[model samples]
Target: MKTLKSRPSAILFSCRARRGVLARGLNTTREIAMPEYLSPGVYVEEVDAGTQRIPGISTSIDRARWQSLVAEFKKTVVPQAPAWTDSNDTDPGVTLLELFAWLTENLLYRAHDIPERGRNAALRAATALSVLGHRCTTECATLTRAHFFAGQLLDAATLQAEQDYHREKLRRHNRMLHGFGIVSGLGVHVEATSDPGGGRVIVDPGYAIDRCGEEIAVCTGATLAFPSVGNEAFVSLRFWEHPCPPDSPSASGEPDVTRVEEACVIGFAQAVSPPALALARLIRADGGWRVDPAFVPPRAGAVMA
Candidate 1:
């Protein structure tokens, strides 16, 4: 009998000689069942290796997965196609990948909420997706409109008005329910002089919550003229939100004026005692500028909410 040894990594098999012929014969099989032997002396054998275990490919979809796929494409395909070097989100390939990711996420959400139904389900899904940083598509927008307004068709102006109304409502709720006052550092100090006209009251830099629940940041100290004698005046911090011209131009000489959201002013209400919203009160008698006995300067770093 001639003995043959297969490669070390392959399964070992032996064939014995009987009546001048090999007792066991080699048979052809599927490619995966056994590796083919092409060498002249190589022999094939059928071995029942049981069930083959094939590893599963990942089908998980997520933002990270999409990002990794983009990275892999950039690594493998960019070299072959030099013209497609741009890997930014603006790139068509990257944008398509993002859209795919969004669709996958949306489908996964629907699958997770398979039992959900009706317009409320659509609205909830749209709101949840929006919270997840997905922009509302036309269908989502329609669903949201139907849910909120009983399917009323809103024009641009009407939509803006509705938005403004809700915003003001929220603001009022915060201002009234939460209570507002000088949160810190709006101390009133009178620079007294023999002539009331020459005197001034300085308001230190401070932060406050106005009646509108809007935060007032006094970046720098402010000064207001002293009230005339025999008159009472109260200092109020007012907040206004409007667009103002930019203070300077950009280095590129382009116009950089943007609308400012918050504009605050230190104002005075004369002949009126300090109201609940007043930061300080000025009582001017025959004496130059008298601090009202009832007036207490807001303590530094004290919250008056």
Candidate 2:
């Protein structure tokens, strides 16, 4: 019997052979023959193709782990500094720890994903506003139109009805789809009241859009009166549009009517629905009314006051 000298390659070969045996036991019929190592320096053993490779662990810190790490740090500090007992948010040490933790959390998030500038660059020139504008223009262009044949008789009523329909469609397009709001100059100001105990305010002339997409113009401004019933009252501008026909018939014997009849009503209370815009909040104290400094006027199409 000849004795074989032990080497590192021989030990590796024995381990691989044992692994192949175990693999064969687990429903694998493939046979693996150990390579003879006559001259040994370094030998490479191929891993089993059927075996699943273990994935590397992620170094990214998640929200839960970050919070745990902050908590652990806080706990560790108590043992090192027994004199430091205050752990409230008002404490300088705790505030600094929380600030540092927040910064670290943000840094970790940025490290794990593409930068914001890179993502924005990927979008090129397209934006939310541009996409919406294109969609509105396309929809308006593709709107259905009534077709008239050569022999079809045209009447004033029919023409007027068609015109009104298209006008309404255009109005809706501009109001709902295109976007409507006060373009500029709708400022509410406190004014002097004739009655000593009454509160009065005046709205500056401005152009705005109503909830129904109708354009409203404050040509000469409007006055709002706040009653002394409550300590606080919200002032709002209300709009009403209705069809107003002329009292006399037109020259063609048809009714001359204005479809877009605009009216502005200043109310002491907040408006509950559309076609309205909140102007200001009034606070009454010592029999005098003043505009609340904290009141913020919301834009059109926003939540109703």
Candidate 3:
């Protein structure tokens, strides 16, 4: 006696009298598995060609292109091919094509997302990133203005002692910088030493150095106000120096300018020597100087010391 064989899997979705009859259409949401028939003896349901076609610019065109290529090649180039059975995970060629398609799809996605504005926002951002120089100010008028907190009273002797301590700190900081091969007092930028009287210590570093020119402006802008009639005043400034003005035509041509926040006194009277601080012209390094309070001189310096 002969027995009946099970129908092909594709017939389940295509035929209405198989699983469709069993579920009675109540669970119509259930997914129907479809199989691809390869040989003449195999039977499979016909698939809608339109279902495989991707829509819109956001869709994966590269994958569609690869599939079309494979289908056309199978039909026209190798009509009788038997080794090419299925496009599955086991096929190395299919995997490679899929990888290539994914990368191409990503490129196409980014291209599609580019903004349609008149001015290129991306180009502007890239240009801003290439700037080499920057300027800033702390709005300090005089050294005394930065010190001496209101309501925090100190005797004249005590105030004098505090001032002396700050000056000494500046001297030591400068000396450390000198030992590091930054000879000129001008090369060192110092911050305002903290005062014990609870006044906010303000260190104002002001300097404008241009890469194209060797000129360095210590303190720019006119004086806001002078110290009280008879008393003397101090002005502190700090800044970082670059090797030279950038003059290249490449993307990295921007000079790396550094600014420091330190204090010093520039006395109006020729009578007193400028506060015991020294400054020298910014020397050129191969790359540039690094901003470090405890910077030690090395055997050789590159873009940074």
Candidate 4:
């Protein structure tokens, strides 16, 4: 006769109880754990998966809501004595509503784009701002100054806001126009010094033209020569365009070098010296505008041509 063997039945209990009993007081933490079974069997426990879900906000819904608001505003808010019949895009009032709806939809989408960890923090800050009767600025993939102010009333909290508004607008304008505009401290320039004859370097003069009355004919740092001691040093750079267009005679035939001067630029000359020179000494690892003194040495008072 064949003999039969029996396996021990599995027992389930709170991890807190097992921790004290099986761990012998070594561990005192309370947590659920599976009991060890003498017999071989598969055991599985369903764990709660926590994921905060944000509901989708459709753009069509936003558009419909805004259209309804616009209709209400025209019918009830505005007096019909003068007549407010224009309800199409041609009407500035209706256009404003459409723009607001588009922006609202975009903002809702952007909110979800934030990382999960950052979303919580951003939402908390937004809530605080809302309570204070202010809303957090929505960022777009491609943002411009025009997007910020379109029939919206700007409520500046402090005196600095006035300056900040101008600075931000100008910065965006310069970025879009690139070389045509002058932006102080927004770029870097490096040059090898011809003075006193050493491996010394100086910040390029393109950024300095803002202070001096002398105008820049060409803002490209190409005028500067490379240092003999190093390879091409500059990692990134910027160039300024001559504010005045090349003297060109118009159809009427008269040389015009006229240019409208820009106003309200941000900070100026943050970098006193070339970054490479500012840091202790130059090494192969350090990179910036390089000038070779042996060949094509820098000339004194060689203004940009």
Per-residue error (Å), model 3, residue 201: 36
Q: Which candidate number has the best lDDT?
A: 2
Q: Per-residue CA lDDT of candidate 1, range 1-305, in tens?
A: 12222211111111111101111101111111122232332323222222232223111223332333344445455556867766486687888888997997698688863232332233233222222221111121211121255777876667657665665655555455554677778777777545425566777777766555555666545554554333677765545332223457669765453433354445455522222247777776675665566976432233246
Instruction: Please give the lDDT score for candidate 1.
Output: 0.43
The residue pairs in collision within model 4 are 226-290, 226-291, 226-292, 227-290, 227-291, 227-292, 228-292, 233-288, 234-288
Query: How do the residues 10-123 of candidate 3 rate in per-residue lDDT, one tens digit apiece?
Result: 111112111111000110111111223323322222222122221211211222223333343454434356567555797889899889989866975788743333113322
lDDT of 3 at 87: 51
**For every model shown, what is its TM-score relative to the native structure?**
0.37, 0.43, 0.15, 0.19
Off by over 4 Å in 2: 1-143, 149-151, 155-157, 175-180, 197-199, 249-260, 300-305
Q: Which regions of candidate 1 fall more than 4 Å away from where they truly are?
A: 1-173, 193-196, 228-230, 246-258, 271-276, 296-305
List lDDT for all candidates, in order. 0.43, 0.45, 0.27, 0.28
List runs of model 3 lying over 4 Å from the truth: 1-153, 179-217, 221-305
Ranking by lDDT: 2, 1, 4, 3
**Model 2 weakest lDDT span, ten residues long:** 18-27
